[model samples]
Target: MILILVDALRRDHVGTYGYHQPTTPFIDELGARGVVFEDALSQAPQTLNSTASLFTSRHFPLLLWGVEHDPIPGVADDRREQWARTPRLAAANLTVAEVLSAAGYQTVALFNNPHQHATSGFSQGFDSARLLDRDAGQAYARVDSLTTAFLDWHSGRDPERAYFAYLHLMEPHNPYRPPAEYQALFPPGSGRHLYANGPPPPGFTGSDLETMTALYDAEIRFLDDGLRRLVGELELRTDLEKTLIIITADHGDELLDHGGLGHGKTVELELLRIPMIMTGGPVGPHAGTRVEALVRNIDLAPTIVEMAGLDEPGDFQGRSLVPLIDGAEPAIEPPEISYAWIAELRSLTSAEWHCMRDLANGRLTLYHRSEDPRGTLDVAGERPEIAELCLAALDRLEAEGEEARRTAEALKTVETDGAITPENAAVLEQLKALGYVEE
Candidate 1:
């Protein structure tokens, strides 16, 4: 099983997703040969928080904030407490890698982002998990080096053992510098900004937006080329009929879609909507199919587990998407809810409307998705019934998440404490340099 997650990849930017640009030819072909979920929503808009939810099949509060922080063994008390408050993947959380490892699979995480360091609990279950540093500035690791590293690792591992490799690439992220050739694909006029330092400057102009979009698409193309290389190599090495390759993203970037230039800020559709495609191997019958039923990134863990024919853990909250992959209808019409704890923002998406709620001030913003996809207009006052329904669902979700968190806290097993280590300081530098955090 090969699961790859591209950081900050917008769903609409892909060619298969109806974007006019050819930003993702490889991804489009992969989707055409796979089962694509038309409305796959992420659990959060940030990497750490969203990926935590992805690996655990849980909601936001349970995965992000509700876990208790403890002191690290080697770190000082006062300094560690503040760093402890940083979001983490708690040991009490059971990861998909851990389950796969226990099932005799060689689980490896050849990742890119600095946010996924060993101290962050992002490496909990993998037999070998480390940050691949074929550095691409703000984009971190180049997908090419990461793919090469995976091939090397696979060649050395026992071939008889079933393996599960999780590769996280940090491309199409920020400081959008694709390879020179790909960068030339969408050469911008000298008048507009191309986001050299980090994100687009505040109050950026419309020309700047177009320029940034071009740069973003070029970065996406760079990643797509890497995907083509990886797939080609994988096909040469493994049997195409027995290789299960899954591709998705943690979250998407904001490019003035809703008056923003970065993510971890809102649960807007542009930020939450991601591509979840399962191709090759067991997806044979359902290949080239598309499922319009709404799904969340949280379902990924369960789906992977089900594909492996393993029993789902009791704490796993998401239902297996295997039925949907097999052309069966979803068991329920669950609302897609995403949380942005940094912004204290949450959104509930249904078939009819999309609702964003600011938890701090209790303000509800409603948007008719079909009418106003960008969500520029707030119809909360005009459509009280829909807003009320969305708010009620969010309330229930929060309650459930809180209760689950409390249970985990009371009956926790592992002891992963936070510390302000030298490594963490370096990681903070990377995240800050990449516009992921404040100074």
Candidate 2:
């Protein structure tokens, strides 16, 4: 199985998702031969928390929401101490990698995102996990570099053994800098600098936003080119028909949608709705199928386990999607629940509505998804009934998360002692260059 995760890649930006731009020709081709989920969402809007859920098949602890330097009431003042106290995937939780490894499959991972590095407890189940080095001199490693590394690794693997390889590409994240050729593809004047140093300046014109979006689209196009090459190589070197290839994003970015410059700040549709395409392997029967049902990232691991014909761990919170893909009704309808947190803001999303509450001030803003997909129009005052329903759902989800946290705490698997070390100077510099951190 091969899993490709692109960082900060919004679904609407791709051609398959109805965008006019030819930003994802290769991905669109993959969609043609695979199942395209119209309403797939990440569990969280941030990488660390969302990926933690993906790897462990459990909801990330709500207590660690803003522990990364952002102050939380009644929490430790020191950021490092907060990280130490933050719950990680316990040894008790069997990761997809560990399960597959035990089942005689080689599990490997190549990621450019620093949040998935070894120190983050994301390397738990992999036989080999390689993160992009800070010395690579770029915030996002080039797609070619990652593809080359993967091809090299696969070259040495045993041909008869089944393998699970994950590739996390960091293109299209931030500081949008596509190659010169791709930059030239856009209109000359449309490439003018916008928010090159910081957030979009006040009084920024619509043209400026357009230019920024053009740059982001170009980044996607660049990555698509690399994917074309990589896919071609895979077909030539291996049996493409039997390989389960899943392409998705860790989370989508907010390109001024809801007036935000980046993600993890809001639970807007653009941030939560990600692209998910599954092709080959057990999904062959579902080729060219588009499932409109809501799917969550947590379902990925269990689906893979089911596809590999292995027994899923009992603690997995997500249901397998194989039945849905194979034209059978799901045994249990998934709950219409999606949760997101950043600092003092928390949002609960359902298929038709989104409700956000500011924990610091107890402010509530509700949006009807069908009427206000961008989440700009607030209807909480006009539609009290919908607002109350959303709030009630949020309350239930929070209670469930609290119960899960208590269980994890009882396992005593959380790292609670100086887990967050001083930032590596090189990694810190790359994050700054990508505009993820302030110098």
Candidate 3:
């Protein structure tokens, strides 16, 4: 089984998702040969928060780790302490990798994102997990290097045992500089000077935004090509009759959609809605089918477990998506909840309404799901009762999530690695270069 996660990949930018440009031919082909999710939302709008849920089958807010969005008021004052407070995948949470490993599969995770390095507990259940080949200071590691790394591992692993490898690609993230050859579809031209590392570019005009969008699209194209190469190599090395391939994004990027260039700032559709595709194994029976029902990122873990014929484990909060692909409804559906730490925002998207509230300022925005899915037309004032109900639901979820987090943290108190250390300076440097920290 191979799980591919592209960082900062927007849902609407892919060819399969209705984007006019042909940025994802490879992924689109995967969708055609498998099951596609038309309405999938990430639990959080950033990598660490988003991926923690992906591994543990828990909502972002419900995770035991510190919510970095505001848990620490002065992030820059002490980088070491900040790293100490870094949102983590607590050991208390049972990860899908652990489940698969115990069930006789060799698990491996290769990623470029510094936040996902073992320090955050992201490496929990894998036989081998490491942050692969990234260059210094905002330079992305080539996708080829990552594939090579995986191949190195595959070549040495036990041939008879099944394998589960998770690869997290960073091409779609910031510093969007795909090689010139990859940019042939959308040349940089005059907008090459724009920097996408931090917040929105100052004095950014309409034309600059267009250039940013093109660069991002080109990045996706580069990612797609690398993915095709990696899959081809795997097919050659081993039999693929029982292979299971899953593709998804940690979260979507914000490209001036809500006045920002990076993510972690909001829970808008651009940041929360991601493409989830599954192919091979049991999914082969449902080829070329698209499931239109709403699904949360948390459901992915449970789905993988179910495919392995394992029952749900450790208070898993999501239902397996296998039922949806099989054209059957689940016993119970989870509410659609999306969250962001930076904005202190929490949202609930239901069949009838899409609601968002900025908890920091108590500002609420509600929209009719079918009529105004983009949430452009605010109807909070016109439909006060519905908005109130949404707010109450949001409040309840937050309360429950907080309590869950507390329990997780309490369980983690037994671990001895909580001390602050000077090595965290390097982590802060990586975070700054990656635009997680402001100057």
Candidate 4:
């Protein structure tokens, strides 16, 4: 099975999701052949925390942000003494890959996102957790090339082997530099042009929106081409009849939506809602059926394990997608989606409301999703019950998550210097370029 992660892909930007541009013809086609999540949400706004939850099937607050030797408060940290004592895989946590490996599936991870690298302890269970080709700083760079190469390599290997591969592609993330040929869609004064040139130019204008959107669309096209290639290759060699393929993203990016450029710093829907598609085996051809029920990033790991016919480890916070894939009505109630923004915003969400508390200060902003889907208007004063429920959920999830973090930390023996490693230096560079990091 092949799992492709398209980093920072906005749900609204794709044609299937109603964007005017032909930004995602390939993905739209994929949607026609698979189930499409209309209201999928990420566990965190950023890649590191969200993906940690994805790999471990745990809540973001409980996963310690994918750094070295840190633990989720209440999980599995108490077993070890120092951070260094923690292996890439901690005692209590088991990645989907590890369980599949034991079940005799060859597991491989080829990532464009550096946080999925071994140094961050995310590569724990894969048989060949290769980081693939990347500069120390542009680890996520050229993700398409890496995906294609990995597929080629996999195809040449034993065809009879049951295998699982996780591939991450960063085509739509910022420093939005598609090739010059693709850039032709945008003029020099456009936001996409300006972003490619360097940072946001002074006094950004709305007139540039079209060109900026065009450039962004062009980048999405590039990734789409690569995705098509990978899918075609998979169809040719794999047991496409029974093999399961899942495609989704860590989060979405905001192109001047609510005045934001990148993700991880905002609680806005533009950055939170991602695309989740599961196609393969018996789940294929369930296409174009939009599932309005909310799904979280935490669900990926558990779903993967269940698909591989393995038992899910207890303590996983996500629900398996098996029932949904089987077209079974959801038996359990939907989860209350929660996100923490240490960068600037802290928020929790339920099916009815989105409540954000500024991390910079304690000012609160509440939007009733039932009343204002655009989130253009704040109604914290108008709806006290909604606000109360969101806050209470936030408080409960946060307390549990914090406890997990503490437990993980207490079990580890290592200390991180707060400096970026050579492997993560490229991620730091992109974060700075996206204005997620300063100085």
Q: What lDDT would each prediction earn against the true structure?
A: 0.77, 0.75, 0.77, 0.68
lDDT of 2 by residue, 29-94 (tens): 999999998888887777877777777777753232222332332222443364444444555456
By TM-score, rank the candidates, best first: 3, 1, 2, 4
lDDT of 1 by residue, 174-255 (tens): 7677777986887754436545322556667887878778888899999999999998998898786687888899888888
Return the TM-score for each candidate structure.
0.85, 0.84, 0.87, 0.82
TM-score of candidate 1 against the unseen true structure: 0.85
TM-score leader: 3
lDDT of 2 at 426: 45
Cα RMSDs, all models? 8.3, 9.1, 8.0, 9.8
Task: Tell me the tens digit of each residue's lDDT in model 3 across 1-439.
Answer: 8888899898999889999998999999999999999888888888888888888777743243553322222123344364556666666567889899999999999877767755667888999998764554445566788899999999999999988899988988887887788778877556643655346667787777777788888999998999899888988987664789999998888777666678887777778889999988889989998988888888888999999888778657777898889988643355554443433788787656778889888999988978976667889999999999988988887887766554444434333334334544454455447443345
- Residue 389 C-alpha lDDT in model 2: 76
- As a whole number from 0 to 100, the lDDT of residue 248 in candidate 2 is 88
Model 3 quality (TM-score): 0.87
